[model samples]
Target: MLPAAAGYDRGITVFSPDGRLYQVEYAIETVRRGTLALGIKSTDGVILAVEEKTRKLQISNVTQKIFQIDDHIGLAAAGYIPDARTQVDHARFFAQSNRLIYDEVVDVEGVAKNLADMAQQYTQYAGARPFGVALILAGVDKNGIGLYLTDPSGTYIGYDAVAIGAGSEQVTEHLEKNYRNDISLDKACVLAIESIFMVSEEKTGTKHIRLAVIDSKSKTLRMMPLEEIENYSKQVQDKESQS
Candidate 1:
């Protein structure tokens, strides 16, 4: 049956409408992945943010493996870096492989759903473990400006805005109070940066951060400039000092 047997006892074949055989998954690979907590919303169709965290003094990069695979779509991660990288890589590969199917553009929402599917498929093929990953994919998909949150177990959701990483719980709390259906890109961006700062502040050993976003309509990713971060940091400091 499953994973127990080495070679296939018989050649597996499937027939299409014209008697065609489709082959998939001869054998499975070991090594499981991890999970991430992702959040998202789609209030405004202007901009969305992806906040990444590793270590304040991290020797190795947390975002080392993940890159902007396409325009208008950025990834933010938390928990099980390697596993998250694998799943994101897999999603990128899958989308690229079928680029033509999407007219040289992969729908961010579609990509996100595919990512969720990945988690389930992985679980079926490999036994579950600590290796789990959560992803927040933000950008305009085939539909419109949107956001998506995916889990290690292969579950995906479309949203208007999103967040992912260590401070998800605290960040979510920040969103509920700030997010609204009519929020604009500028407002959403501020909320994201602010939420991240709020979350990261809770953790003692975090400093430098990576932030990126996919503007509405276009598929290009723009990383938030360091100066922008400095401004936000200043604001954070001022608000904290006020409190």
Candidate 2:
């Protein structure tokens, strides 16, 4: 086992002798315990899927994992819900501010970069702590469809497809085998659903799954209806049975 970072382990503002921030690493581990959130970018669009856990008996069934940052951008987060909400709020503010200032919607990459920069600031400040969330952001811009993953450390990267949270390793392997560069939006949605199913610990049904899709042609970001998701879940199960 690796030894703990001497002083850095106690605070986010501290860096160890090995140049590691133990507090940031600990925050990332918190995200790993969240439900799965995955994204895939395809020829026609991008799809984001997340597994929703119903924590309380009286709570609503609607999943809170997926959120909209703008008309063209959507985000799904894996980690503490409160931290996710804080990040999402920040993203919305930046996106809107850019539009008001530039008279154009903020591009997907721009939004990701701004959020990453903000998240990174928390790690460098003495009193602040890194967000315990990893975000999967998807959207359509002038450059076309895009997908990005941002971690608690404020590091962000683009991807054709990616997964976060528990069982992400298995989900990544599944994506590698099935992902295609020329995949269509419908196929991408199917893959996203399948990936979530593969990694989720609980028995995930349609109601427990939430999805967001950004269509390049329509230039719209919309959430998949529960009914459609239910149908897709049935289709995935049928295909698995046949296989």
Candidate 3:
């Protein structure tokens, strides 16, 4: 006997009898298989973090999951990262073009919408697979801090704090308990690390953590240094002991 999704699973454009898109669902499952990635919006700005496992001999300095889309916007991705790079390149071009034409920075929501629209297009066409990556986009703009999550099903939603990838459901529950809208940027950084550590295997060090921030004051994106990450890790440990 054939399964319910038998034929629908083979094509992005086909919908199952139950009105589900199997290819899109499969793409989302690819995101579930990735390492953890998350973002938090705080009173001061936004923080993005991800867990990355590396071989001992690997340099480990360069981050593979976090990317800068513009001076004020940063992205953290979980899933098929090659798809992420391709999307990032497209976003960079779109951002620069927006600046050139409007003589102003693009709105964070605009970029999110653009990517969501692009993702949607793939679902309506044939001969191409949906992007298997999910992205957390965070930025500081005139509207203040913005954070959005985009998935392979062509969905984009806003969030104060969100997580994606392996163990994300667990980490997300942690964020729900710990996240505060009034939290300071430094505190948000600590919270981001704490959430990652809750699910990360290399629990003791900052080596597997990749961090980035877009502060309201600066309205620019910057990578958090290892030294700062170590400090945040200590804070996470200290808070644990007290609680």
Best by lDDT: 3
Q: Which model is ahead, 1 or 2, in terms of TM-score?
A: 2
- Tens-place lDDT per residue, model 3, 1-243, is 259977778888888899999889889999999999999998989999999989989997789999999999999999999999999998899999999999999889989989998888988899999999999999998887899999998899999999999999999898889887799989999998998888888779899999999989999999999999999999999999999
Runs in model 1 deviating more than 4 A are 1-62, 126-131, 201-207, 237-243
Q: How far is candidate 3 from the true structure (C-alpha RMSD, Å)?
A: 1.1
Give candidate 2 misplaced runs (Cα > 4 Å): 1-3
Question: Per-residue lDDT for 139-192 in model 1, tens only?
Answer: 666677766777654567766554555555666777777778877655555565
**Per-model TM values vs. the true structure:** 0.68, 0.95, 0.98
Models sorted by lDDT, best on top:
3, 2, 1
Per-model C-alpha RMSD? 8.9, 1.6, 1.1
Question: Which stretches of candidate 3 lie above 4 Å from their native place?
Answer: none
**lDDT by candidate, in order shown:** 0.55, 0.87, 0.92
**CA shift at 8, candidate 3, in angstroms?**
1.5
- For candidate 2, give the lDDT of residue 44: 87
What is the lDDT for 35 in model 2? Answer: 86
Could you arrange the candidates by TM-score from highest to lowest?
3, 2, 1
Instruction: Spell out the clash pairs found in candidate 2.
Output: none
lDDT of 3: 0.92
Model 1 residue 1 CA deviation in Å: 30
